[model samples]
Target: MSKDRPAPGDRIKPKKSALVQFTATTLQLEAFVVAFAAVALYGLRDSLYEKGPLELSDPNVIWVVGGVLVVALLVLSRLTAKPVGLAGGTVAQVLVIATGLALPMMYLVAAVFVAMWVAALRLGTRVDRERREYDAAHPETAPNV
Candidate 1:
């Protein structure tokens, strides 16, 4: 046997799966919802730019700004380990709602995303609770492995 290996009588413990690790926290799920919302906003760029009521020198400005917001939210998602990330998400949601100033249609989109974000936070919390309970019940089993 390899020197690093445990003795014959030692118990082998399973490791958590990658998916479980990735979604282990409520922040992660909230970040995911925010990121999804960002992408959805980006997808509407062309339409918003062309038909949006905002009178800008160039319609492309909308696309550029929206794209930046999307990228920022995506980055925030990965930074949810810190409290600031959640704050950033809240700010992002406000910005999304503010998009209505440029494109009235965005009000509806933003509302939908906000609903989704709230749902993610609530559901993620429940899932996390369940995971903790499961781990408590099965001390020897790797959580969500």
Candidate 2:
């Protein structure tokens, strides 16, 4: 047996699979977005209630939510350093912004925004995993590899 190999009775083992690790990293990236949304919502709630300066009423809530969605999308794109989900995210974001302006469709806007963000997060996780696997498989390759 190789000297570096674990003994037959070794007790330690890693609990997480690659999927779990990818999920955890994706969630970690989203957590920052969630935190930022919470802070922005708390700070601007009064202004989004139709009585604020924008006069957009409930529409302002959409703005706040959309803002968070966009920021989160940007962060994910940057973290992955890939354009994989950017186009889809941008489309969803545009839908959010437009739907918000309609004033009475806040729920739909929120739902779509949430769906898009989740999709983007998943895409990021996949990208991260694929990249990691590629690096592992090509560990010793130079530019020609």
Candidate 3:
């Protein structure tokens, strides 16, 4: 058998480095955050209408619109690259914040999501840096992919 060939019963598999894995995970988490917010707001639409101070007869409109926007942005973020994903996440957070105008509780929810977004970006960057340093120090271990 050739040196490059795997022996019988062996399988060749593509390997994702830590940096790639972390980046993918972070993006997915960001998307999930917005998606969760959309679903939650939609679920609480009736409650918000009943308890919120908004004078509109159909407060569910706000919830539905916001949910749609967040869900759309989440889909776009997942389909695009890092910059688009980050921007979409930011916009989704802003939408969440804007919901505070209708229901005050959204302010707290927005803040929590914002915190999570920041943590994901910062920690993912740190992980990327470490992965780069490791790759630089040990080039042989780096994956071809």
Candidate 4:
């Protein structure tokens, strides 16, 4: 059986949620950075004791902690499609910033990501709101489908 393709304008447009999209993007990027931080910590493993400020007794500590945080971030990325995920994402952001305590340099990284998260929440919400209003005004393209 042959199927016909819809005209370009007749094709269904998916309803994209700005908040979820932005939150996922932010979490995914943060996950990548956290993964890199794990690798950097592995490189610094030998020097940690000499530096002596951190009490990490095992070299694998970074891998374990960073891995968990990365997983949490990735999960949060999916969860953002829901309302509860917004709060969860905020909590995750705090945890990411807290990494600054163990790695002082993470303060810079944390600040940048924190700013991005805040911007995502603010801007994404605004965009979503505007999109809803537009859809409401023009109902032809606003069906749940």
Q: Could you say which candidate leads in TM-score?
A: 4
- What TM-score quantifies how close candidate 4 is to the native fold? 0.84
Clashes of each: 0, 1, 0, 0
CA deviation > 4 Å runs, candidate 4 = 1-11, 48-53
**Model 2 CA RMSD to the hidden true structure, in angstroms:** 11.1
In the range 70-120, model 3's lDDT, one tens digit per residue, is 566557545434576567666666776776665566678678767766766
lDDT of 2 by residue, 1-145 (tens): 6766555555434332343344334434544544454454445555544422233335456467656665765454444433444444445445444434433334464564566556655775686677667656854331222
lDDT for model 2? 0.48
TM-score per candidate:
0.61, 0.32, 0.63, 0.84
Candidate 1 lDDT, 54-119, residue by residue in tens: 543453664577567767767766664465765776677788777666656668877876776666
Query: Which lDDT values do the candidates have, in the order given?
Result: 0.58, 0.48, 0.59, 0.82
- Please identify model 1 stretches exceeding 4 Å from their true place: 1-53, 143-145
Q: Which 10-residue span in candidate 4 carries the lowest summed lDDT?
A: 1-10
- Residue pairs with clashing backbones, model 2: 50-57
